[model samples]
Target: MATGRAKGRGRGRARGRDETQDERADRMWSELIQEVRVAQTGVQILFGFLLTVVFTARYPQLSQTDRTIYIVTVVLGASATGALIGPVSFHRLVSGRRIKPQAVTWASRLTLAGLLLLLATMTSALLLILRVATHGDYTPWVVVGVVAWYLLCWFVLPLWVRLRHTTID
Candidate 1:
């Protein structure tokens, strides 16, 4: 009495989601867009704030090193914002092309790239801030520690879950 049909019963599907390839793509695209929206809001806000730093009175008082760090951080933030927003443009251009699956793949890649850029921007911003907040020698150590934490949370845990618990199709 073995019904080999994995249809409708949600069997033999990866992670028990039980969906067709197109269905999976659609679900994933929706999920990816939602995630992008959250990240986009954060990065856009951070980038906007970064853009305003040059107008602050304290900007001219910053050391040359700090200025360089600020510039790099701004560039990273802008890049992250672009990458995070790239998916929308990609989706718009490909909407009627009958390539939802391909579009989803590309969008996911862009989101990952955006996340990486955001990490770099955050690390640079932290370094600059800590350097200004405390002139002590421990500033670098604090930045490194914070970067490690971000890495753990942003990259390591998700990768571990994907590798450890995911089933291959």
Candidate 2:
């Protein structure tokens, strides 16, 4: 009878792990914090560099179109920074609320949003830089190729692995 109750509780839970929901949430939260730390550092640095670009001697020499791209890139970087940092703030406000599982879910969503924003920010920054460095027809082509690489490495490969290796049990 005790074995039956244990089996019942384990149903619909992750396979190959004998952890309670709260234990799983704690593990996930730790992993998420590590991941967020890496992304946050990168976006913060990128955003800082973007902030300084306007003060550079080359700023006034930029074409109107290039300036527009720069503005867009800066805004994207700022947004990505915000999104990446949001999970920490969210966790702080909701800590000790007996909602670790919910908090983890929300944090995961924010991290994903942050990653997407970072991708957009990087794409715009690359495009603007290439345009400024070389006024040639190959600029867009180069940007497209780099963006494709990012998409493959950041999104496609991980998703493919998940789909190919994940089991239904």
**TM-score, each model?**
0.89, 0.91
Q: Which stretches of candidate 2 lie above 4 Å from their native place?
A: 1-14
Model 1 lDDT, full chain set? 0.92
Supply the TM-score for candidate 1. 0.89
Writing each residue's lDDT as its tens digit, candidate 2 over 1-169 gives 5553366455575345667999999999999999999999999999999999999999999999999999999999999999999999999999999999999999999999999999999999999999999998999999999999999999999999999979886
Error of 1 at 4 (Å): 6.3
The regions of model 1 sitting more than 4 angstroms off are 1-15
Poorest lDDT segment (10 consecutive residues) of candidate 1: 6-15
lDDT of 1 by residue, 5-81 (tens): 44445554433665788888889999999999999999999999999999999999999999999999999999999
User: How big is the positional error of residue 104 in model 1, measured in Å on the Cα after superposition?
Assistant: 0.6
Candidate 1, residue 82: the lDDT equals: 97
